[model samples]
Target: MDSFDEAVDSVREAIDRGDNVAVVSDPYGGRDAVADEAEEYTLGVERISFSSVAEADGYEMSFGGQVCVVEGCRYLYTRRVDGFAPVKSFLQTVVESDATFVTTWNSYAWSYAAQATEVDDIFDDVRVPSLSSAEIAELLSSDYDISEFLTDYEEVTADESPSLRERLPFERLRFGIEEASDNVFEKISGMSRGNPGVARAVFESRSWQTDDEPLDLSYDDAFALYVVVSKERVSRDVLRRVVSPDSLETSLRKLSDSGVVGFDGDEVVLRPQQFADAVSYLERRRLVW
Candidate 1:
């Protein structure tokens, strides 16, 4: 797959032409790549995130403080819009600052906003694409396979099909990864859902290692993590209704400590990079509707 550079380039081109741009990407897909490009263009990048529109009510001061720190700093946000207020705040931010303002959104969330509000009027929008299988293979072939890590080849994928590491779109993306106790790369390719970030998470979960040197992650933990990340943000109460109490705290703690998820008081969210992984996991479990 192509690097998400084209979407990043479009935003850069818009800003150069003095037009603000809005980008919609999958949770683990393209937003940060755009942010990274923006950072390269200015003194600093003011990256902000909001779990919901209500949190955006008074973003002026937040945006202002950053502008003051670095004049003409690139301003970027990834706010999940549940109402019109965030769109209003986005306009308000651009209106208040003649400086360029760019916003990123989750693809599913953006589609919902398009129908519910007049967000279409505010900025030019683009939806980023998922990574290609070639890209996934390239990533997997790097610094993986402990057995291979110690061999002459740091990482090697079979030149053959169904050779887990070398395969792409390897299996049905919906069946949550296969058990770590049995197959590893099959699970990685399946659950990752053609998304780079999710594949990276599966790689880091260390599920590929054999029993002699194990990092055990249970199906419950995987599914619980999935519930928290199926959307941008989920309330603790909602999680309580879904996740078993006996398992909730443990799952939350493991995900948090592993940098896969985070807590905002009573709310739980998938950490930025971990979002794709959670999606892959949930899809595999058929827990997503």
Candidate 2:
């Protein structure tokens, strides 16, 4: 399962145990899936749109057992500054109510909303920002062997349009690195990570390597490499390939249960680091003591 799937599943499981939850996100990003999964998993769900939040106060008061799942929302609409007042008001209902909350968004908007809301202590906020280079370096320090994670990296493809990178944050370089790491493992035995695009361009350069070594790189690998070399985030597919491998699915699921890497659908993402001293913790996990 990707990061989205995992989050949905976790909330569903929580609801089954009779806990109410608030799953929030944009409309396009799969609100229905949560409803379906909640029903399928027997977790009673109630979906609330932000536009309906003012009306929801009574609903929450009246509904006793169902899990209140809110989706298709932004903390505030991007076009209007006036949007914040409604959002804050709606969030206040959630804060005052006895409900668990979950929200999703694109990294940029999420960060902005998070800053505007400043209600970190009130809600158990979970931030699933696209990975960055610093995170990859941090993961390497952990005892987490990435052989499994590498495969999910293969399923995702990079956008051919370079303009995407310009729109996304530089911190998202982790997705590119994870994708590239997969490519390096599958193709070039001694791939260099010095420059992001170097390894990928090597294959695309249309030169000596393909003619001499005849490396059998698939489109999946190509996409992985492209993101890596370009220093871009891996799209959804690649992240799916890494954590949801056929053989290791069960183990990965268990790891997910232990909250190591989170899943939204099939994409795998790391949790926010809890410890202040990540570098040392990573080193210990790597057994580099």
Candidate 3:
């Protein structure tokens, strides 16, 4: 079976054995898809979605001996040292209650929480797998009538010119292509690291290539980017507490100018279209594992 079906079966088996389940994935990974699919197998289970940490405060899970699916469990806390109180309390309630809880979390947040708290002991994790090249192609084909994927030649150097057939990246043109291969999808999948959302964004345009020069971030800026990505969407106040206060503002300004991140009122978030590029940049610098 495919990854989605395997994830659903894992959840079903865990529930059958009376174990709490934790659905984990990277930011913009397919956590929601797996959780939603699994929820369908859970007849009569109540699903509660927490949009923010404040929404989870004092929320008791009293479902009268039924299963409960908690979506957006990643939003239950920030990455700050002091910000875990809300999620800790929420997890405590889950452990003490009679309801079988199936929760979803961002993989990075889950990794940190598992290290710092008893989260690893409380839930059995079912991690969402990265999409294969074929899977990425299928996902893109569903939305766009992609008859052919031409190879991009903009980056080719004069000294090392490639034949039209050997160029791999998808060209912007949609029609009148003479050849087709899996190379284009493989390139996209590799660049996106097989994250579907990132793959889709990369397919639309080469987002990593900005008019501005390539990113040259300092350690503080890189760390700040890591924190923002890990939390998905973090409030500026909470972000300040976690990153170096002296350079936080400057770091954010640089990232914003590079179009790597954006602001939503008081919250800072990684730009969805730039997600793959940002993550790749971080991984290269050893800022993210």
Candidate 4:
């Protein structure tokens, strides 16, 4: 496996050579990190976030020589294709002109566009992978020293907290949780499916204990919430099929109480991170089918 720097450097080389790169990363994980790293390669970097076609239009008048870092392209219209035209037009400008286009995308958005549009055909797309264990160690050892914690310690302080890393915080979370128990990390690894965004999401929302007292929760209730999240915007009809009719409403209510899920009369929804974490949690517990 290429070291993180090696992988990043390869992309940096392309941008310096005036080649546009479409960086696809799992949601909320690597795109921003890649964009941040772009500054090291280019003399000047111009960052822009466009919500719609109208916004994309203004891009032409903005700047000239700097390498333009474009983000929120996935926000064109949620599906990443329906609203890609305007941005595509703007990007065409980047192509014909001298400016370099360093674009970023959410994995899901890129996946959809790949199937439905010429997005994949039009650009050089690269998917960033999660760092390896040794890579993680090599990367974070200098910034953190967790050796003392292998044996019991008084308590972890903010300075020593593994959560403090601004980038790849979730990767360190794996090592930290593993320090508590190897078995827990194994489940987290499998649950994340090696995706950093998914892994970090699991870490942030995990509330396995509070003062050594587990929250008042049952496997079934947690399972109910998991189903809700995995399905994405679960409806009452679908909820009835997964949950028993007798306890359907009660189970739903309990899941909502868990704070990981939100339910309006219309549907049950999970925040992006919560959704990924719940999927991992349920899979680890063997609660998913």
Each candidate's clash count: 5, 32, 0, 0
Encode model 4's per-residue lDDT on 136-248: one tens digit a residue. 33332343453543222222222333343224456545534543433333333334444455545544554222222222556767656655543445566655655665787
Q: Which ten residues in a row have the lowest lDDT in candidate 3?
A: 172-181
Q: Best-fitting candidate, measured by TM-score?
A: 3
Q: How accurate is candidate 1 locally (lDDT)?
A: 0.54
lDDT of 2 by residue, 21-124 (tens): 44433212334455556555645445444332233223333344345655434423332335466556556766666655444333334434556665444444
Minimal lDDT window, size 10, model 4 = 150-159
TM-score for predicted model 1 compared with the true structure: 0.57
Q: What is the C-alpha lDDT of each candidate?
A: 0.54, 0.37, 0.73, 0.55
Rank order (by lDDT, best first): 3, 4, 1, 2
Off by over 4 Å in 3: 57-62, 150-182, 206-214, 284-286
C-alpha-based local distance difference test score of model 4: 0.55
Name the top lDDT candidate: 3
